[model samples]
Every structure is written in structure tokens, then in C-alpha cells.
Target: MIRDLARSVREYKKVSIITPILISMEVVIECIIPFITAALVNEIKAGCGLNTIIKYGVLLILMAFFSLLFGGIAGSTSATAASGFAKNLRKDMFYSIQNYSFENIDKFLTSSLITRMTTDVTNVQNAYMMLIRVAVRAPLMLIFAFVMAFVMGGRMAWILLVVVPILAIGLGIVIYKTFPLFRKVFTKYDALNKSIQENIKGMRVVKSFVREDYEQQKFEAAAEDVCADFTKAERILALNGPLMQFCIYLVMIFVLSFGSYTIITSRGLDFDIGQFSALLTYNFMILSSLMMLSMVFVMITLAGESAKRIVEVLNEKSTLSNPENPVYTVKDGSIDFENVSFKYSEKAEKMALSNINLHIKSGETIGIIGGTGSAKSSLIQLIPRLYDATEGVVKVGGVDVRNYDIETLRNQVAVVLQKNILFSGTIKENLRWGNKDATDEELIEACKLACADEFISQFPKGYDTYIEQGGANLSGGQKQRLCIARALLKKPKILILDDSTSAVDTKTDAKIRKAFREYIPDTTKIIIAQRTASVEDADRIIVMDKGTINGIGTHKQLLAENAIYQEIYYSQNKAGDQDEN
Candidate 1:
């Protein structure tokens, strides 16, 4: 995990290396100051002159200033390196997500990904800052202070070494006990984020159903789970503070009692007052270094879980990739599905789309009608290689979609999905997603074909009108028409509308179809709809049932031969008659 995460520190490596070097220099200066003070104390005791005391005092101040300077510089460099590393990490994760296929995306929750990018990345960044600074300072300070303590007060230094193992064992136990709890806590964080995201996204539905109290209770439950787990982990980590303090006090008591007795009895021959003072300073330094180390370990324990989550995203390879040598051009809009079968995952009990054989000529107008879960969308998704077939070949423009570059195939086959999305941007900007370089005239023309220009021209800003996120400001019919206009800007060879016109009135739907039939006669149009009237004028209609095609024929032909089609068409006509009456 360390090796994987370190790769994000590409340009910051120099700063990362410099931070530790500065920390080491600071530790060295800090250790030397106590030794100099010890010598000065001895000199003053031996009837030293005022000039000698002044010289030692000046040297001590210089050493202290340099220590602070190195420490401050180390702080700046570590912050630069850690923040840069985090920026790079978030960039890499986002770019990776953009390349993932639908199947790969389905493996992770949207909320989980958001948490990994934001909160989890922050946790790792803070831990990295600690690792480069405190982590480096602690060990160096402990080693230098230990050596100096022995030199200043021999035999009493053994007392420091004896306490080290006891503290080490205690810290080890604390970390081990808390690590699993922290891991569980992070998982709960993902759940909490998911709950908040769901509530916000479905706020309208919650309010419509008068379920505000229920949603509040649900959010509180998720939040409580996260807080409970974190509290449990912190409770275990709290032992670390008391353990370190106990060892520090024990060491201090032993040093003072023994050293005072030695000084009084031996009459300054052994462990004198000057040496005793310096020894106490070194003792505090060593014990404080251990305290810093314990804090570092606690941070590492928390960040360990976060780091694993981040690395999981970084290590995930897109389940789909371009071929070594890929076809970049599409010949035409002729699509063929040959003995194709697909299941969302290898472990799925049933196929979403079972062995299907179908073909459509260029410029053909095809309509598909299916019940819920009939795999109508699944069958079309394979044409653009959004998800590859598990068993057989799906060909677009007479070449297997897998053989074509993914971008090339998807561009040629424009899909206006069932759920239309409009980002927060001007109308022109949203339309330009289909063709970034589309001229104003082209935008008007596409909107006209989609029957969206009439409403757009009525708006005060026209094409420049600002759309709220998800097009929430517009009615459902308006959003659908705008999305269609956006897809029409692509001028794709094949256009598939996956129940996209469900919100529009039947008269408007007919007008849009008529415009497509008149203006884009050479583009293959596939429409999936619940209303039979939407597909009755098509060249061919497909009836899908239970993940398989039940019948393939023109509207009148299907109505006579296919039971499912007859049931759907007659029921719709009966409802229409009753409405008119």
C-alpha cells in the first residue's frame, strides 16, 4: 500500500525528502543544547567569570534559534508535499473513474467513491504530514537524547532503556486493539454518506410522500452508527495517553530519587548537580519523543483504513479497455447481434439478455416494446460497447464493437437514456455536449428536429438560458425535448431513444417523429416506448418478453400474430376510446 500511494508523490518527492533532512538537523541541534547547558553549569559552579557565562548563553540562544528555523522549514515543506500528493491522488482517481465501463462502475456505490475522494483522501493527507515530520523527528530525537543522557549521567541511563520495552509493549497492544475498530468505523462512514446522498437526491419524493420525519430518523440512524463505531475506536486509543504518562512519571521518580541520593552521599564526586540538571532535561526529551511517536502511531492507525480504501480505487483496473490496435471509423449504422447473451456479473444467477439474434439495416426505423425487466435497454447497450456481451459478438457497422475504439463506436451511436441528465449550464452549453463545436445555426436546427425550439425560443434568453442542475427548473416534457436536441447535435449514424419521450404529449411525440423521418432519413432510429402509438408507424417493431424477442414484425403484422403485441395494442386502443368517450 505504501509503494502504491507513494507513486502519487511524483513531483513532490524532493520536498518529501527535504522535510526529513530538516527534521533531523533540528533534532541534532535540540540534543546539543542540553549538553552545552550542562557544561556551562559545571563552569559556573567552578567560579567561572561573567564573560564565560555570557559566551555559553549566547551559544545556547544561537542553537535554539537554528532549531526553530529548521523546524519551521520542515513544517512548510511537509505541508507542500502532502497537499500536492493529495491533489495528485484525487486527480488519478477521477481520471480512472472516467475510463471505467458501466459494469466496472456498478461494482462501486457512487457515495462510496465520493467518500474515498474527499474524506478518505484528507485522512491520508494528514497522516502523510505527520509521517514526514513527527515520524522523522521522534526517532532521531530519542536516539540522540538517549546517547547524551548516558554521557551526562551514566548507569542512570539504563533506567531509560528499561522503560522503553514496557512502553513499546503497551503501545503495540493499544494499536492492535484499535486497528480493527477503526477499520469498521470507516465502513460505517461510507454508509452514512450513502444515506445523506439518497435523502438529498430524493428530497422531492420524500416531501411528496410526507415522509420528512421518516427520512430524518433514517439519517440519524446512519449518523449514530458512524458515531458509535468511532467512539468505540477512540475509547481504545485513549489508553495510549495514560500508558505513556505512567512510564514517564515512573522513569522521572527513579532518576530523581537515585540521582539525589548519589549527589548528596558522594559529595559531587558522582552524578553532580550540573549533570543531574542536564540528565533531567535529556530524560524529558526522550520521554516526549516517545509521546510524539505514540501520536504518530494513532494517526497511522486511522489513516491505514483510509489508505486501503484509496488504494482499492487506484488499483482497480477498468473491466473494459481499448484493443492494442483499434478500428477508429464506423462504416455505417448497420447493427447486428449474433447469439448474444449477457449477465451483469459472473455470479449473477440469470442473464439480463439471453441469446439474441437480430439485424437492422442502415437508415431503418425500428421500435421496441417491452415490459419492465425485459432487457430492452440491455440489448441496445451492447451496440455501443457500454457493456460487452458475455457469450457472443455484437457488431456495429459490420465490425465487432469490441474491435472498434470505444470512443469511436459510442460517438457513432448516440443514446438518449431513460433518465435524462442536464448539467448546470446555459442551454447552448448543454446542447454542445453532443458536439462541442456546433454552430448556433446547428443548435437551432437540432432543437427544431427534436421539437424543442418552440419552447426554447419562448424563453427570454433563448439558447443562452441558464438551466438549473438536472434541469430541475424545466418540466419533464421540456427536459426530455432538450435532451433529444442535445443528442441530435451529435448527428450520429444510429440514434437510440430509451423511453426518452414518455413525458411529452402524444401529439408532440408524433411531431418529433415526423421531423426525424423527414429531416434525417438516412439515420437509423430506434425508439423504445410504452405507448403503442409511438411505434405503430415504424418500419419494424420488436416485442420483447423475459429477456428474449417474442416477435419481430411491422405494427399491423405484430398485432395479428404476436399475443403480447395484440394485448398491448388493443388495451391501449381501448383506453384511448374510453378517454375520448
Candidate 2:
């Protein structure tokens, strides 16, 4: 895990190295300052000349200046290194997600990934900064100060031995108890973020259903879980402060009492006033360094869980990858499925699709109709290799999907999934996702085919009109039409519309289908729809039921011979007649 995370520090390696080096220099200078002060005091006590005092004072000032300079530069470099590491971590995680096959993405929740990328990354970033600077300074300061104290006060320096062990034992207990609580807290954070994400994304439905109070209560429950764990962790961590204070005062009392007695009894021979004062400075430095160490440990405990989560994403290999020697060009839109069976997960008890053997000729218009959960979308997703079939072969353009370069295969096979997503950008910008170099004429023609140009032209800015995230400003039909237009711009050899035109009126839907038949006849078009009218005009229609193809034939043939098709067609037509009545 450490090795995996350390890889993100790539370009910042130099700065990361420099930060600790500067911190070590600062610690050395700081330790020397206390010793210099003790000697200067001894000289003054002996009634030294003004020149001797001025020389010691100047030397001390120079040491202080160098310490400050090193400390300041270390702070800047540590910040730079930490921020760069965080950027790299986020970039790596995002790129990994982009490459992940649909099966891989399903392994992690959307909310969990978001938390790992944002909150978890921030926690690790702060810990990295402290690890580079304070972590280095604290240990060096403690060692140097302890050595100086031993040199000046002799046997009296042994007081730190007692305090150090006590503080170490206390910190160990505190950290051990708090570590589990912090781990639980971050898990709760994922739940809390999930609650907020679901609520905001479905705010429209929530309001329409008048479920504000329910959502609020749900959010509160998730928030309370996070707060409770954090509170428990904080309660345990609070012991560090009292434990440090007790140790500091215990050492202070022991040092002052012993040093004063020795000074009075030995007449300043064994332990003089100058040595006593320097020992006090060393005591503070040593204890404060320990205190810094305790804080660093606490931060590490918090970041440990975050680090694990981040490394999990970084180490994940996409379930689908290009072949070692991949075929780059798709011959045509031909699709063949032979004994294909698929389950969403290895642990799933039932296959989502099973025993599917079908063939689609290039440029043939195919329509699929199935009830919810019939795996209609699952059947089409395999064509583009979105999720590789768990059993048997799925071929596109006469080649197994796994044999083709992933990007090349996907570029030739365009899918407008059931969910229509429009990013926050100008209408033209969103359309450009399909073809980056598409000319204005190409854009208009594609929109016209999808029947999106009519609504887009009504906007004052036309194609340049700004679209809100997820196309919030547009109607459902408009969003669907625009998405279709974007897919149309791809000019793919195979286009699968997974119930994408459900939002548009039947007339507009017909126009889109007519456009496909007239303009892109050679492009194999597969449409998944609920309404039988949508598929009645297609060359062939597939009836799916419980993960298998129940019937495959022309619409008229299915209606004549297939019981399921008869039931669906007659029911929808009956409902339409009742509505007209």
C-alpha cells in the first residue's frame, strides 16, 4: 500500500526530498541555540567584557536567522510536494475509472469513489505535509535536545527517561483505541455523502412527492453516524493533552527541585545557574517534540484508512483491456452472439442473460421489446463490449470483441444508453463530444435527424446556448433528442439506442427512425423500446423474456405466431383505443 501511494509523488520527488533536508538543518540550528545561550549566560555571570557578550549575542542571532530561513523554505516545499501528490492521486484515480469496464465500475459505489477522490485525498495530503516536515523535525529535535541536556546537566538529564516512557505508553493506548474509531468514521462519511448525493440528484422527485422530511431524516441519520464515530475517536484522542501536560509538569518539578539543591549544596560547581536554565530549555524542546510526534501519530491514524481506500482504486485493473495485438479497424456493423451467458458478478446466483444465440447482419434495422428486468439493455450492451459475456463469444464485425482495440471498437459502435447525460457546456460543445472536428453543417444535419434542431433553434443562442448539468433546463423530450443527435454525430457503423427515444412523441420518434433509414441505412441500427408501434416498422423485432430470446422475427410474423408479442401489441393498442374513446 505504501509503495502504491508513493508512486503518486512522481514529479514532486525532488521537493519531497528537499523538505526533510531543510527541516533537519532547522532542527540542528535550534538545538545549538539553547547550548549557545547557556554558554553566553556563564560568560556574563563571570563578568565578561562587552566585546565577549556582543560576540556571543551576534553568533546566537546568526544561528536563529539560519534556523528561520531553513524552516520557512521547508514549509513552502512541503506544501508544494503535498499539493502535487494530491493532484496526481486524483488524476490517477480518475483515469483508472475512465478505463474501467462497466463490470469493474459496478464493484464500487459512485459515492464511495467520490469520497476517496476528494475527502480521502485531502486527509492523505495533510498527513504527507506533516510527514515530510514536522515528522522529520520532531525526532531530530528530540534527539539533539536530549543529547545537549545530557552534556550540560549530566545525571539530571535522566529525568527525561522516566517521562519519555510514560508518554510513549500513554500515546500507544490512545492511538490503539482511536484508530478503529477513525476507520469507522470515514466509512460513515461515505454513507453520509451517498445520502446527500441521492437527495440532490433526485430533488425534483423528492419535492413532487413531498418527501422533504423523509430525506432530511435520512440525511440526519447518516450525519449522526459520522458524528458519533468522530466523537468517540476525539474522546480517546483527548487523553494525549492531559497525559503530555502531566509529564511536562512532572519533569519540570523534578528538574527545578534537583538542580536548585545541587547548585546550593555544591556552591554552583556541580550544577550551576547557567546549566540549570539550559536544562529547562532542553526539557521544553524534548517534551514539545514528543507532543509533535503524538500529533503526527494521530494524523497518521486518520490517514491510514484513507490511504487504503485510495490504493484500492489505484491498484484496480480494468476487467476489460485491449488485446496484446489488437485489430484497429471494424470491418462492418455485423454482430454475432453464440451461446452467450452473462451475470453481473461472479457471486450472482442467476445470470442476467443466458443462452443467447442471435446474429445481426450489417445495416439491418433491429428492434427489441421486453418488460422491465428482462435484460433488454444487457443484450445490446454486449455488442459494444461494455460488459464482456461471462460465457461464450460475442463478435462484432466478424471479430471477437476482446480481439479489437477497445477505443476503435467503441468509436465504431455508438450507444445512447437509457440514461441521457448532458454535461454543463454550450449545446455545440456537448454535441462535439461525438465528433470533435464536426463542422457546423454536420452538427445541424445530425440535429435535424434526431429532431433536436427544432428546439435548439428556438433558443436565442441556438447551438451556442448553454446547457445546465444533465440538461436540467431542457424538457425530457428535448434532452433525449439532443442525446440522439450527439450519437448521430458519431457516424458509427453500429448505433444502439437503448430506449433513448421514450421521452419523444411518437411522430418525432418516427421521424428519427425515418432519418436513420434514409440517411444512414448502412449503419446497423438497434432500437430498444416499450411501445410496440416503435418496432412494428423495423425489418425484424426480438422478444426477450427472463434473459433469453423468446422469439425473433418480423413484427407482423411475431404478432401472428408469438403469444408474448400478441399480448404486448394487443394490450398497447387496446390502451390507445380506450384513450381515444
Candidate 3:
């Protein structure tokens, strides 16, 4: 945990060092004021002249002013450092997540990732801020007070020695008991996050089924569990403060009683009553510092757990990394799979795709159709290297796909997935994401090619119209067209539509296909569709069944030669006839 924390801090080397230095200055200022107060009190006890006492009193005020000044500086610096650290960490984590393969991402749920990125990072930031602001002061104050006490009265310092040990034992117990509880709290937090996210995202289903009360009870149960664990941990750790105060009081009694006896018995007045009073002040300062240290321990325990969780993410090695010394470019869009097989997990006996062999030439429009989970999407996903084949080679441009730089290779393939996601932005802004430097004329042309221009122009603001989150304001068909337009704007060598036009009517789909033929030049198009009419005009159609290619041919050839394809075609046509009757 400490090593991970050191690594996290090292990410912002300059700021980390500067924050501690400022905090130290602040603590030194605080420690000096107490000593000046002791001097003023002793001066009055000795019957010092008014001028001397007044001078010491003014010095004490100056120390306090400096303390406040340094405290402000330290706080500002600490906050700045913590904020920057969190921002950079989050940025790095997001970048890493983007690089993760689909298989890797599947290991974590969306809600868990969200919680880690948000709540977990905030926890680490808070811990870092506390370390910078309070951690340095507590230890410095304790040491300074101890030194002052020794100088004021040697024998009186023994009380501190006894009291400090007892406080340490109590702190150790609190830490030992509470550290494990914090881990449990974080686990429960992930569960709570998952429950809330699922309920909110599926709110429509919840309302349709009238499960609101059930969901409320479920949420209440989770909250109650978390509350119970939190109370248990807090109850155990909360004992520290009262126990510390008790210890402090006991030490104070010992100091005062012993010091008074010494002052009276030692007639030589070697250690005067004035110094005895100063010792008491120093003892209180030390006790307060100890209390602050105990709180730091609790924070460190929680932060330690959080740090471990964060490190797990940062240290994860992506299983889909490109080969070292990878080839820099792909020459053409030709894709080939030789004996390609894949599975979601190694433990699974069955493969998602087995012994798949196919070759797609550059500029050819090929279609894939199959039953659900027939590996249609999985096959096309290989072209863009979303996941590597488990057993065989996937090649692009006559070279193994793994040979090309992952980013460079993916840039050449634009895929519109079955599930279309759009950011909150104007239509023009969303299109620009495909190609940041694309001109306005190019954007409009791409929109026209995707059959999106007509609907976009009908909007009140046209291309400048704002889109709600997830394109919620748009109809499903409209969203699909915009997604298609976004893909076209990329001008990629390979364009893949994985059931991308399912929401559009058959006529609109045909129009979009025709526009693609007119505008896109020499682009290898792979269309995965459920509608038979959508892919009937393709140069080749591959029908998949149970994770294997059942037949590969043109639409007419498949209708005559393949039983499964024939069945699917006849069934759909028969359904159309029945509807007409």
C-alpha cells in the first residue's frame, strides 16, 4: 500500500514536495506561538517589568499571525496539488480503459468502473490533501512540544513518556480494528452504485412493471447494510478521542502534583513554579498533537484500501497490446481470417467462432446474416482488432493484424456498432468527432450519403441543433442515420455496419445503401443485418449458424442452394403474404 502511494505521489513530483514544505512552515509557526506564550507567562510569574512582558506578548501575537499566513498558503498549495493529481490520474485511467479489449472490459461492470473513476478518485484526493495539510503538522508539533517540555522542567517530562505510550496502544487498536471495516465499506459502496445505476437506467421497465416499491425496498436494504457496517467501524474508532482525553487528564494531574511537590521541597528553587506552568502548557500541546495523529491514522487506513483498488486498475496489463516493434501501416483494406476461433472465456468448452476461414477483398461489399449469437458481429469486430482471435491469425492488408500499431490499424476501420451512442452536442459537433479536421462541405456530403441531411435540415436549428444526452431527443431511426453519417465522415478504408440500420424503414435503408454506393469509393463495406432485403443486393452473403458459416454466396444463390437461408427467406415472405391476406 505504501509503495503504491509513493508511486501515486511520484506522478506529481514537484507539487508533492512543495506541499509538504509549506505545511511544515505552517506547523513551525504554530509551535513557536506556544513557546512565546510560555515565555510571557513565566515573565509575569517572575515579576518582570511591564515593558518586558508587553514585548513577549506582542511577539506571541506575531507568531499567531505568521501561523495563519502559512496555514493559508499550505491549504491552497495542498488543494491545488490534490486536484491536479486527481485530474491526471483520471485522465490516465480513461486512456488506459480506452485501450482495453472488449474481453478485458467485460470483467468489470459499467457501474463499478464509474464508481472507481469517480468516488474512488475523490477518496484518494481527500486522503492526499489531509496528508499534505495535517500529517506534517501533527508530528512536528509533538516533537516541538516534547523538546520544550524537557527544557522547561526535566522531571515533569516523564508524565509525557507514560501518556504517549498509552495513546499509541489505543491508536493501534483503533487502526487494527477499523482498517478491515473500511475495505468492507468500499465493497458495499460498489454494490450500492450498481443497484442505483441499474434502477435508473432501467427506470422505464421499473415503472411499466410497477416495481417501484420493490426497488425502494431493495435499495433500503443495501443502504441499511452499509449503515450498519459504517456504524460498527465508527463505534470502534470513536473510542480513541475519549480515551485520549482521559489519558491527557491523568498525565496533567501527575505533572501538576509532582511539580508542585518539587517546587516546595527544593528550596534552592532550581526549577521554579513559572517553569512548572510552562511544562503544563507544553504537555497539553503534545496531547493535542497526539489526538491529531490518531485521526491521520484512520484516514491513512481508508486511503490505503482505496490506493490498493486504484493500483489494480493502473497496473493491469492489457491483453490486446500490439506486438513490440510493430509495423507502422496497413497498405489496403483486405481482411483474412485463417482457422480463427474465439471464446469469451477459456473455461468455456464451446467457441463463439470456430475454424472460421474467409477472405474479404478491398472495395467489396459483403453481407453477414445469422441467428442471434451466431458470431456475425464477432467476426467483423476482428477486422478492427476489438478482440484478438484465440487460436488463429487475423490479417489485414496481407499482414497479421497484430503486426500493425493498434491505433494506426483501428483508424483505418470505422465501425458503427449495433448499439449507437452519441454524445451531447449539436449535429455538426457530433459529426466532427469522426474527423476533427473535416471541412463543412465534407460534413454535409457525408450526411447526405447517410440519408441524414433531410431530417437534420428539418430541425429548427438545422446542423447547429443541440442534441440531448445519448441523442434522447432524436428518434431511433434518426439516431441510426446520424451514426452512419459520423462513420462516413471518417472516410475510412473499411466501413462496418453491425446491424446499424435496424431502426430505419426498408425504403430508407435502401436509400442509404444506394447513397453509400454513390459516395464511398474503394471502401470495403461489411454489413451485418437481420432484414433479408437489406443484404440481398450485396456481392456476397455469408449466412452463419451456431458460430460457423453455414453458407456463403450471393442472395439468389443462397436462396437456391442453402436450406437454412431458404427457410429464413421463405418464412419472411410467407409472413408478408399472410399479412396481406
- Candidate 2 Cα RMSD (Å): 1.7
* Index of the highest-TM-score prediction: 2
Tens digits of per-residue lDDT, candidate 2, 233-311, equal 8888888889999999999999889888888788557677888999999999999999899889999888989999999
> TM-score for each prediction?
0.97, 0.98, 0.92
Give me the runs in candidate 3 sitting further than 4 Å from their true place: 1-12, 25-36, 258-268, 346-349, 575-581
Higher-ranked by TM-score: 1 or 2: 2
How does candidate 1 fare on TM-score?
Answer: 0.97
Alpha-carbon local distance difference test for all models = 0.91, 0.93, 0.84
Compared with the true structure, model 2 gives a TM-score of 0.98
Candidate 1 residue pairs in clash (backbone atoms < 3 Å): none
TM for candidate 3 is 0.92
Candidate 2: the clashing residue pairs are none
Sliding window of 10 residues with minimal summed lDDT for model 1? 572-581
Q: Write the per-residue lDDT of candidate 3 for residues 387-446, one digit (tens) a residue.
A: 888889999889898888998888889999999889998999999989889898988999
